[model samples]
Target: MISISETSTQRLRALAAATAAALLLAGCGTAEDDAPTDTDVSASPSAISLPVTPVTIELVDPGAEPRSSLTYEPAGEQSVVLTTSSTVSQQIDDQAAQDFSTPEITLPLTAQAPESDAGGEIRLRIGTPTSADQRLTEALAVAEGSEAGLTVTDTGAVTALSISPNADAEDAARAAIEQALNQAVYRSISFPSEDVGVGAVWTTEQQVVSGLTLNQTTTATLRERDGDRLTIDLRIDQTPESATLELPDDAGQLAIDTYTMSGSGTLEFDLGRSLPVSGEVTVAGEQQYSDPEGTTVLRQDISDTLRWSTP
Candidate 1:
C-alpha cells in the first residue's frame, strides 16, 4: 500500500488521476430532527448511554490491515481500458459478467481530542491498501498519503479536505478522491445530541455532489442495549439521481440515468466508554450508464464491515 500521508505531493496527484472511473457512493441510516430527551424518554431492558458528557469518539488505529472493499460493475462492455500504473488489466473480463472490487482499504481513523460537547473537528489520516489485486491496489492508491487529508466534523460530515490531488492531478482523480473521501466519512459515527435509550431513532441527509446529483440519506435506531454493549439497527437509502458524463474530445459521453444505492446493517456502541465497538452494513444498488455507442449498466451488492480496536 502507498503511504499517501507520507507520499510526495507529485505522486499522490498523479495517482488520483489514474483511478477516476469508479465513484459510486452511499450513506448510513438517519436520525430524526428531534431525538428523545433523557428527562422524558422510554427506557429499554439494555443500558446504553449517549455522549451527554464531554467524551471522545474515535477510531483506534489497527496497524496496516485490510479493512474495507469497494466494487464496481459496469452494465455493458467496458469500451475504455482501465490501466493501472502497470499494464491494461482485464480483471473484469471485457464487458462480461464481472464485478471489479478494489483492494481492501483501511480508513486511517486517527484523530486528536474531539470535544463531543463542542463538536470539534477530527483529522483522518489515510494509509495504504492491503488488497492482493494489483489493479485495485493501484486504483485505490491514495488512501494513505501525507498529501491527502479528510477533515470531518465530530458529527461525521466531511466539512473540508485536501483529498483532491494538487493542481497536477487529473480531473477524474480529483473528482474520485472527493467521492471516496465523502463515502469514507461515514467511518466516523455521529452521536445523538442528547442522551437517549434504545428505540430512539434519528435521520441524516446530506448532499454529496454539486447540483444535488449524488444525494444520500440514512436512518439509525438504537435497537438492543446491555450495559456497555449496545446494538443499533441501521437502514440507509440513497436518492435516485442521474446525470450524463461529458466525454473528452467528443469520444462519446456516458450518462447515468438510473442510480440509487442503499445499505442495511447494525452498529454496536460502548456507551460506558463513549466509543464505537463494531458495525457492519450490507449495501446493494444498480445504475444505468448510457453513451453514444450503447448503454452501460452497473450493479453492486456487497457487504462492508468494521470493528474498532481497543485503545
Candidate 2:
C-alpha cells in the first residue's frame, strides 16, 4: 500500500483548489468609472499583504513634439463590464497530457473614488460572474457580489489591494478569486512621469509573487492620443527569481528546469476614468518541474479582455 504524508495531502488539496479557481476565473486588467461623487469613507487597510516592490518606469521615447503630461483623475461613480477566457494543459511523468478550456466569462463592476483631492484611492464592487457554459456558470455562482478595493497613484501604480469574497463562498472559490484579482492588479500599467505624445515609449519593471516569485517587465508604447483618451500597446515578460521553489506544508522542493512567459496586448485608456477604457492581453508559457518522484510539465495559454460602456 502507498501512503502519503499529511503535509503532502494538504499541499495537494491546495493545488487542487487553485486549479478549480483558475478554471472559472482566468484574465487580467481593470474596468472604467462614471462621474465624480464625494466618498466619505477612509481607505480600508490592505487585506492581502505581500512584500512591496518598487516599480520603476523609464521613458524610452517622448514621441513626436507637442508632448503633454498624462495623469489619472478620479471620476465619480461608473459602471463597466469585463470578459475573460483561458485554456490550460498539463502532463505528469509518463501520463497523457490533458487540455481544458473555459467558456467566456462576463463580470460587471462599479467603481467609486474617494473624496480626497489627491484621488489616490478607488473602491470597486464586482457583481456575479456569468458564462454561457452551464458548468462554469454553476461554479461561479458562489462568488456573487464580491468586492475589491485598491490604492493606486496618479500614474496608475497599484500599491495596496484587498478582496472580500461572498459570505457563503467556499475556500476554493475564494482562492481562485484572489488569484485572479492579484493578476489583474499586477498586470495593470504604470505611466511615466514625463510628458509624452503619440508614439511615446516606456518600460516598467517590478517583482510579483503569485504561485511563484517572478521578475515582471512591461514595455508600453503610446499608439494614439485624442485629448484625454489614449491607446497604448503593451508587451510583458516574466522569469523566475530563483531555480528552486519550496512547496507549501513542506511537501518537498522542486527544481525549476525551464520557465518562460510572455504576452502582448493593447489598452484604451482615459485620463478622466479610474480604469482602462478597454483592453485585451494574451499570454502563453511552458514550465517544467522536477522532483524525486519524476518530472511534471505545465503549459498554460490565457487571454483576457476588459470593456467599458456607460451605465
Candidate 3:
C-alpha cells in the first residue's frame, strides 16, 4: 500500500485537476487567449462545434520532376480499423514518475460522404473501443457508437469538426474521447496547393493551448509516391508562447524557466482513403516551473501510433 501526506494529497489533486483541464483544451485547436475554460460534451453536436482554424502549408521545394497534385478523391462508402496506442510519463519535482500511459486502443470506424457534394461533408461513425486496461474500457463504455462530423477540402484540410458523446459519460471520459477525435480528424497532412513529386518539402504552422500556449510547427517531406499512395516524413517542434502559466481554479501560477519539445516520425497516406494508412509520432520534453512552494521540474514523454485497414 502507498501513503501520501495531507499536503501531498492536496498538491496531487490540484495537479490532477490542472492536467485534466489542459487535456480538454488541447483539442480545441484555438489560440490560448480565446480557448474556453471547459468543454460541454453533453450538448448537441452543433452546439459543441469546435472552432475552425485554417492550416497554412508553404512549399519549400517542389522536389524532382513529375509533380502532381496530392488530393483526396472521395469514392463510395468506406470502413477502416484503426489501432492506436499512447504512453505518457510525467515526473514532478523529486517524486517518483507517474504512469499515465494508455493501453493499445482499437477503434473501428466507417465513413460516408454526403449525398450532395456541395458541402463536402464526411460523416464518421466510431464503433466500440477495445483496450486491455479495465479502467479505460469502463471509461470508454459510453463512447460506443459515437459519431464525428467533419468538413474537409480536397487538399486534406479539415475545416470544421463536431463530436457527439453520450450524455451520461463522465467529464474525464468525454474529454478524452473528444481529444482523440480531434487528433484523428485534424492530424492528417494537408497537401499544398501546388503539385509535388517525391522529395517534395513543405511546412505547416498551428497554435495549441493545453496547460500552456504552444506554437507547433511541422515539416513534411515526400519520400515516395506510388499511384494514390504516398509515404511522408514528419518533424515536429513546439515552443511556449509565454513564460507564465495560470492554473485553473486559482490553484496557483507557475513561472516557466525552460521548456523544449521535438520529435520525428513517418506516415503512409492514401488519397483513396479517408484516414492515413499507418503512422507514429513521439515527443519528449522537460520543463522547470517555480511557484511559492519551490521550483519543480517536470519531464514528459508521449507517443502515439496508428494503423488502418479496410474492413
Candidate 3 Cα errors over 4 Å, as ranges: 1-47, 114-118, 168-173, 292-299, 306-311
lDDT of each: 0.38, 0.63, 0.65
Worst 10 residues of 2 by lDDT: 27-36
Deviating ranges (above 4 Å) for candidate 2: 1-53, 99-104, 117-119, 132-136, 292-311
Pairing residues by index, what is the TM-score of model 3? 0.81
Deviation in Å, model 3, residue 11 alpha carbon: 5.3
TM-score of every candidate relative to the true structure: 0.50, 0.78, 0.81
Which residue pairs come into collision in candidate 3?
none
Kindly report which residue pairs in candidate 2 clash with one another. Answer: 34-78, 35-76, 36-76
Model 3, span 73-95: residue lDDT tens: 76667777766555656666667
lDDT of 2: 0.63
Rank by TM-score (best first):
3, 2, 1
Ranking by lDDT: 3, 2, 1
Better of 1 and 2 by lDDT: 2
Across residues 181-263, which tens digit of lDDT does each residue of candidate 1 receive? 43444433455444455566666665443222345566776676565466767676766344664433233344555555666
Task: Give the Cα error of residue 235 in candidate 2, in Å.
Answer: 0.1
**Residue 222 error for model 1, in Å?**
0.8
